[model samples]
Target: MGPRFQNDDRVRLYREMYEQHGPIAPVVLPGDVPCWLVLGYRELHRITSDSALFSRDSGLWNQWPNIPADWPLLPMVGKQPSILYTVGERHHRRSALVSDALAAVDPFELRDRSERFADQLIDRLCGRGSADLIADYAKELPALVLAQLYGFSDQAGAELVPGINALVDGGPDALRGRDRVQAAMSGLLTSRREAPAAGVASRMLHHDYSSDFSFQEILEDMMVNFVAGHQPTADWIGNSLRLMLTDDRFAASLSGGRHSVAEAMNEVLWEDTPSQNIAGRWATRDTQLAGRHIAAGDLLMLSFAAANADPQVRPDRTSFTGGNSAFLSFGHGDHRCPYPAQDIAEGIARTGIEVLLDRLPDVELAVSAHALVWRSSPFLRGLASLPVRFTPTPTSAAGVYR
Candidate 1:
């Protein structure tokens, strides 16, 4: 099994494969889908950086046209009418639209919203001695913040997350989750058109930016942003908490004022990146890479998780990698995550988790690290629930939500 396909000890599997098979190893996926898994750090950099040779457009894939309707990997590799599926000038144009919408957002506002939401969420469970941080605190933080970016309230955010969660769950009923997300988005678009607001959703509907993309096209990009932003941001928060609470390095750094929450975030990104592998990129033509023969239209999976953890690179895991650009957490080249989403995601995770640590000073995991359940998603790595226990710490003279 590959990184995304593995439920337990995923990193170990990727490492074992890389050690045994060298950089690029051809492997069969769950449904007997054959593809080459790229596990070398430098090799992955080369493939992702040279996008011209390795196309993101699924239309270029020779096999997809003949693949069965229920191909298990379709949900992972399926192309949408969005930037995620386009390349060249078309990719640039759609990327500009997403970037512009994100640019309009204020990062400071995102930080404030994150802290506020954390306060509210923690306030609910701090009275009790225990809580599930994933479900109760970490999971919804990104969705609620994203909702604000889209000009909606927490009520709308709450309605949208369950469906998105299901879609990413990679189960047989993923379509039901997809349909729910679409319905929620359609309703949001209708609501914004009916009563315009100052968020991204309303702006997409009313702005002159509509001149670039049709209303439907705008919705497609927003769906991408929503799904993309929520999963990783939520995962990063959960992962960051696990690292900070359990890892001695983080504890020492934070206690000694040597590291900020952002440092912990970068460490997590470098170590256990939200998604172990970026989805399959088809070879544009026959080419040789890392001593392996490559055929046209063959699937190439970039193991960002494996690469970042490569011993040749990260020989010293204790060293800080905040300045390291070699870690492809946000990816590289034309397909990199939008700058705004990246910024907002980091801000959300850092600010939210930092707030939790400050408020719940004594919080610790309720179960052993090995006992925590990893979420099953083709595109993300996150825990299903982060159950935690802490003394019932009350807020200052100010109210709990304060």
Candidate 2:
């Protein structure tokens, strides 16, 4: 599902998997959980498109009887009341509610917030002449911005960052992190219900389909939305910066070439997407996919990184994929990340990168690009740290962001 080794090249790993298994192949998860890994671009698109055949409901999984209580994949594959597992008419309404709430976010305000948070992060390190971009800037920026949009005050948002990071890492702290985030969400919803102020939470509560969804259901959706928004956007920012700093094609970006920033960001989506794989769809009935026989209730893990690099669509894997947005970095069809949500993510990532380059024009790697390590997770892909050095400069004199 992901790079086995911290230093393993993911692109090479995906290539090897595709060459050996073609489009679809069987693979084992951490607990020896068997599932189909959909690696072909066309195959993945078909699975997402036909939700009636491949349902999002984890309850349909045939492996549930064997899954243990302590299993690590439970958090992902577990049957919850969130929109991820919702089906038919209800799921459609829930998706619209979320999309509309996120769509209501002002683009100008979003960009302003992104730039403000980015500058605040860079200001802390600009005078040091060196910093780990992943920890200091990339990882912190998304959550802070998202917290505000999700209806939390600045102090409350700052407090939620550690829990959000821990939750995504899926480490031992994951449970506690989940609790922390849940508690904060619960509080936010309670307050928004009372005051009905601005932000996604408030909007969701007041939507036309608001009554169609229970309070618990809305809370679950907020949890899903918050986690989904934070980590991947953070990874996108980090991965794009890593590409621009390391690849010769983007060398001009580090030297004040603004246009290359967008090019580098787009290239990262195709080549080094953050949301690499998904826990995925469960079969509703027996069906054949890519010549493989599927039993009813069988699980299918989406290999988005593999699908994006599928040789069928991308015959020339080495060539630049300039301005092409056809990549499956975000899934397709019914369960795909909403368009407005995608726009919000792009705004945050692009603004963050642009602000960093504008602040530290000479920023370059402090360690060799090859020496950089990746975070080992079965789903998401991102650098562990991106240490770099640049000329020291004074911190920003603006007051702290509220």
Cα TM-score per model: 0.90, 0.97
lDDT of 1 by residue, 1-402 (tens): 344454656666777787888889888666667788888888888887888899897876766766788776776687778778878887787787777777788877888788888888788888898999888877777887888788766777767777877776667777898998888888888888889978887876766556677778878888888888888888999988888777776775344343556777888888778966777688989999988989998888877887887777877755778756668888878898888778888888888887887787778889997777777654577778888998997754334542
Q: Count the backbone clashes (under 3 Å) in each candidate.
A: 0, 0
Minimum summed lDDT over a 10-residue window in model 2 is located at 1-10
Which pairs clash (backbone N, Cα, C closer than 3 Å) in model 2? none
Best by lDDT: 2
- lDDT for each residue of candidate 2 in 361-397, tens digit (9 for 90 to 100): 9999999988998888778889899999999987776
Query: Candidate 2: TM-score?
Result: 0.97
RMSD to native for every prediction?
2.8, 1.5
Best by TM-score: 2
Model 2 global lDDT (CA atoms, 0 to 1): 0.90
